[model samples]
Target: MIEKDIDVLVGERLAYLRNKKGYTMRKVAEALSIDPSYISRIEKGHIPSIKILQSFAELYEVKLSDLLESGDGVSSIKIEVEYEWFEFVETMK
Candidate 1:
């Protein structure tokens, strides 16, 4: 996967887990030793450094892959297949 894919997936997963744990952005930021605004930007997929992603994953107690795959636990190459189709469709239309 590309850097953008990692950023988007991790950001969305961070936001999801943070909300699931009933924590505010401020609270999560404090726990992660990062700025609240940085956390917000990450959740918005603005693409921060790799060090930041590792930090976030550690704080959330989730594996890096956990954030990448479907939250529903189903694992397959379907996501990639869909993305290829999306790219094809967008290019065609």
Candidate 2:
């Protein structure tokens, strides 16, 4: 899938998870020590840094992979491939 498509999917998933956990963007931003605008940007398809994504996963008590997965029939294999790519990029950093 295209990178932008992945970004949107991740953003949607993030929003869903945040809502499910009863967190406002401000609350998530405060807990993650980031700007609330950043959370809005993420929800609007701005890809966050790996560190930020990891922080979100921890705060939400979810696996990092869960954050990357989309609810809309995206295959697990595809998600896994993307996740491995993310892990590789993180390791390189």
Candidate 3:
């Protein structure tokens, strides 16, 4: 179903944002005052309610649109890998 795909995409975005911010699931859970397992479930493609999604957007400091988008107009792994490598290089300095 379309809704299921959207959930998976949103979940992927959630996981990506959490990782990009260097936050553990426990940290996010604590910030949201939610069980860590719930965060894990959301990251595993479970469709959370709109309220929960709004909370995640706030916690991650991102627009809800960003969480729902297909990734900045690009979906290529090559681009993502190169970008991540560049980010890693920056952290090394």
Which candidate model has the greater lDDT, 1 or 2? 2
Which pairs of residues collide in model 1? none
- Candidate 2 lDDT by residue in tens digits, 5-86: 6777778778888988999999999999999999999988898888898888889887777766544443232443556786
Most TM-score-accurate candidate: 2
Higher-scoring candidate on lDDT, 1 or 3: 3
Q: What tens digits encode model 3's per-residue C-alpha lDDT throughout 1-93?
A: 124465667787888889888999999999989999999999998978666887888988876656655566322221122465345434533
2, model 2: CA deviation in Å?
11
Alpha-carbon local distance difference test for all models: 0.65, 0.77, 0.72
Ranking by TM-score: 2, 3, 1
Provide the lowest-lDDT 10-residue window in model 3. Answer: 73-82
| TM of each candidate vs. truth | 0.63, 0.75, 0.71
Model 1 residue runs over 4 Å out of place are 1-6, 73-93
Compared with the true structure, model 2 gives a TM-score of 0.75
Q: On a 0 to 1 TM-score scale, where does candidate 1 land against the true structure? A: 0.63
